[model samples]
Target chain A: MDKTVNQKAWFLVLPVFLVVAFSAVLPLMTVVNYSMQDTFGNNQFFWNGVGWFKELLDPSTDLGGRFLASLGRNLFFSLVILAIEVPLGIVVALSMPRQGWTVAACLVILALPLLIPWNVVGTIWQIFGRPDIGLLGYVLNHIGIDYNYVSNEIDAWVTVIVMDVWHWTSLVALLCYAGLKSIPEAYYQAAQIDGASRWAVFKAIQLPKMNRVLLIAVLLRFMDSFMIYTEPFVVTGGGPGNSTTFVSIELVKIALGQFDLGKAAALSLVYNLIILIVCWIFYTVMTNASAERKPQEGAA
Target chain B: MARIDLVDLAHSYGGNDAPQDSFALKPVTMTWRQGGAYALLGPSGCGKTTLLNVISGIITPSRGKILFDGEDITPLSTQKRNIAQVFQFPVIYDTMTVGQNLAFPLKNRGVPKAEIDKRVAEIGRLLDLEPYLNRKATRLTADAKQKISLGRGLVRSDVAAVLFDEPLTVIDPELKWQLRSKLKALHRELDLTMIYVTHDQTEALTFADTVVVMHDGRVVQSGTPAELFDKPAHTFVGYFIGSPGMNIIPAEVRGREAKVGDHVIALNRSYDKLPDGAKIEIGVRPEFVEVVAPAPGLLSAKIERVDDLGRIRFARARLGDAKLAARAPAGFTSPDGTAGLKFDPSHVHVYADSLLVEGAA
Candidate 1:
């Protein structure tokens, strides 16, 4: 018997390789180069040789101080956003009807916010939350509440959190809705026959079925919240006294605001490393949970 | 086990002019005996599932009273009705182990831990799922998952009834026969009331003691399989129950005989009370029809097609404007040209205006 084979299929992957090399690898190499050396205005450089790393890791240094603070802030923000958005999204998804033009209308409305650019979201919120002319602030002041987001640290933090929720909660809701829709009607009938309460049905059938999509929602929200910059930058300018200064905002301050090339490079690398490690941990944990419950690979 | 009674039960999806357009289930009044296995058999869109759902309290009848053991249960929810249902596809929790899935209802009802374990083990054994008890349900094959679904429904022994809605449709042919027999044995052992709904005539006839033949949203006849075959209450039942169904030949009733195109067939009993000018049809099971070599018979037909189903050969022929089918033993052959057909007067059924005449046979 003769075997038939096609080796020319390698050509199909060439364009993908070139695109990744140009887009991802090139920028990554530049960041790696910047992290190792100190440069002055005259295009002359000095071998820092991990000097920036030592400074950033040292407990006594200002860079170290900002690094720890921003890391804590970012972690807190991501956790809060996940805690709020996931449940809220699930509630919204469940309340939506299962059929007809209404479902289409709800989906279109939910997706509208996701289509807006991040910078535009930030700009819109910045203007919308103004103390003097903005409708929200005007209504609040008329209702006799001293609502000043720009000057109050707590208010700024609250505003940023709320903005993030409004901008991204739909993503989690949409994912959950898709998961819910994919569930077979048979499961619901079974639950009905089992005399399962509404809560039991949701806990046993809906939640377990939505696990894969929920993991995606969590990881996406975590990574995006960790690297969030444009919205907070446009709204608070990392202000109300560094209260809303997340890691990304701090990295920009060190790189462009202070012109500390060596230190900024080290800080940026550290930030990237933190994200990669956390994301890896999240992925590993979720994948293991799902795989452990996956039915045996093959059975008759 | 308790007997269920449905009184004046009718359901309509939306109000419309014609009955078919409005009501999925026409008004039905019937009583199901305790611990009896019953089947609602019909083709698709014949309202079998709708009737089953109404009995299970999943769909409330628009006009009816449902009584379980002489108590009105029309207003009760499905959970309150204490009925277990098995669906067309398996409905097991994929994340839970097979043992856990079986134990879920008992646990929810606060059954003692020891009792739960014993019940789960028994059900697992019953379903041949003991080997996969510790394995997660999602990893099992489709058939295995369906077995788990069946186990879940059967685990709670104190439930009022067990309803199956085409539950074996997803199983492969070989496995379907296996599981169906298993279900029959389980019903005998448990002595539980079981109502199975299926469009397949074989499944209905083989599994249930009493087969409820339904058509166009109403129950036409409910009786033993033999009764449905030998003495159908309605013309629809005569045409719907058998293989190739029963041959319905259009005829004009004259006194005590039925007149086909050019010949008259004698009826064993007379229906002189039938209204004048009433259009009628003669019904005969394919098994009772005899094909002869131009003997003194009622009508002559040309053979159209022949179907050989191993043990039996069914010959389809046309008589005048009506089609007739006859079943004979495997080796029976049809002649080359026109064939004479004769029906036993004792087996002949006379229908007037789509309804069986009172005294005609």
Candidate 2:
């Protein structure tokens, strides 16, 4: 049978196409346009070709150095967050009551931090870490530990890291919790019958079962932490001489604060490229972890 | 291997002060002999799995003790009990190789490395899992995972008893048969005390030397397959054991005679006297009901429907208020709407209330 090709059928997707164009494609196209040009005040523009990109890529230049520093800061923060949160999340999720009214209450409480607006979370913690009036700050100072988030770079980094953890650790915990819940009761019972110890049970059953969800948690946390702006911006304002300025904060400061659209546009594109490349790497590793498995190898 | 004895065992998921009727497993005393293959057969919520859990020490019974060869072990955990159980769904360590999965139990007990490897290899070979020994458990098919689960149970020689709770439930139909036969063969070869729990009668009958039929959280009957078939002690057992089950019809019994709608039926054994308010019933299997030409001695039946099941034709007949199924042998003539049927005297059992009456066949 010969199949008839219908040209008019493409009209059915016109609405979705228009919606995507307006919502996504248009703004990205504007960014792409800005990325390729030099902008002056009063809407004046000059074609720069890849001049901005070249400047953004060079560590010798101030702009390139700042971008690299911000990139390193973002990567380091993400690593620290992951190192602290992943195991902590698993422990919390494991200790969580498997059933009963307590489960609902715990979930609602755990989800509370995630529900807070990012800027509001920052504001809340900014006051929370105040040396004079804040409970945490006052307590830390009274304990004879020098605590100040405003002037000290180390203090500022710690406060920002702690704030991000408080705000987002719930996400990791919840993902791990969902993963833990999905394991069947039979696994636990079988492990018991097999004389598996608590650690053995965790290693053999719980940990492997939580693998997929943990991957999801890591990816989500990595991406979100990489592009994080509002929370740290509101709380720390990239304080202590740019010690906590992640790439997104740097991009915002360059574009709007200094009105250097050309450099900012270049930085933004590079930042986006970094995110895409990192996410692709994560996606590749996770998918390969499953794909590299030999199909029915040694199976009868 | 140990002879597991449940001494007045009872369990209730509901907390203390719960009534007797609320107990998931009612107080019952039973023993599973050493090296015997027994099946706990019942419908869902009939306490089959509950009983299996109790035996494996997964659930501590609220009342009474569990004994293994005369040693009371009620306070012991499943690990302490040295019991191994294969669950309804295969439970395998997904990250481990099949060999590691099988060797887990032995390793946990601090068995020597050489011994663990030897046992793992032995079980792997027995279960036809030798080829998959090095494979990751997650990479195998559903049945292979189940085989690994079964292999884990068998790897430990010191296991007091290996319990199976509907272990074949997750396997595909074709694989279920093969795995079930393998389990039977393993039972014969190892002579381990294996107590299987299932709702399937065929699974119970084929895999076990003794089948314990349960209903409403109580053991209705425990006997060999042939005994349960020929003589179901309880009305529930009669209704539950066979394919179409036993035909139980309300009857009035007085001495050696039984009356159904004023039609007299001969009793093979004598009933000395009747108890007041006894709910008498005559139970007979469909296979034992003989269809004969319309005769004076036979009970008249109206053949409502004949279900042709290839070789044997099953005739569902209306005998007064009762629905009786009678199976015709191969190459037998199909009876018309009106046919006379005789309840095989030797196979017929008289029930008083729901319990089989003493000295009544």
lDDT of 1 by residue, A1-300 (tens): 887677887789889988998899887777777778888747677778887888778768898988888888989999999999999999998888899999999999999889999999999888888878888777877899888889998888888999999999999999999999999886886787787888889988999889889999999998999999999999999988898899999999988998777778899998889889998999899989867665543432
What TM-score would chain A of each candidate receive against the reference chain A?
0.90, 0.92
TM-score of 1: 0.91
Candidate 2 lDDT, B105-211, residue by residue in tens: 99888999999989998998899999989977878887888788878888888877989989888777898899889888989899899999999999999999999
Tens-digit lDDT track of model 1 for B1-361? 7899989888876643456546899888999998999999998998998888888877877788989999999999877787888888778886689999998887777789999899999999988999999987888877888788878878886788889999887778998888899889989988889999999889999999999988889888999999999878888889888887888888877767888877988888887787777778889999888666556654778778877787777778888778888765455566685677878878888887767776734
Give the alpha-carbon lDDT of every model: 0.85, 0.88
TM-score of 2: 0.95
Candidate 1 lDDT for residue B43: 86
Root-mean-square deviation of each candidate, in angstroms?
3.4, 2.6
Candidate 1: where are CA atoms >4 Å away?
Answer: A1-21, A100-105, A135-147, A281-300, B15-21, B112-115, B130-133, B295-298, B328-335
The residue pairs found clashing in candidate 2 are none
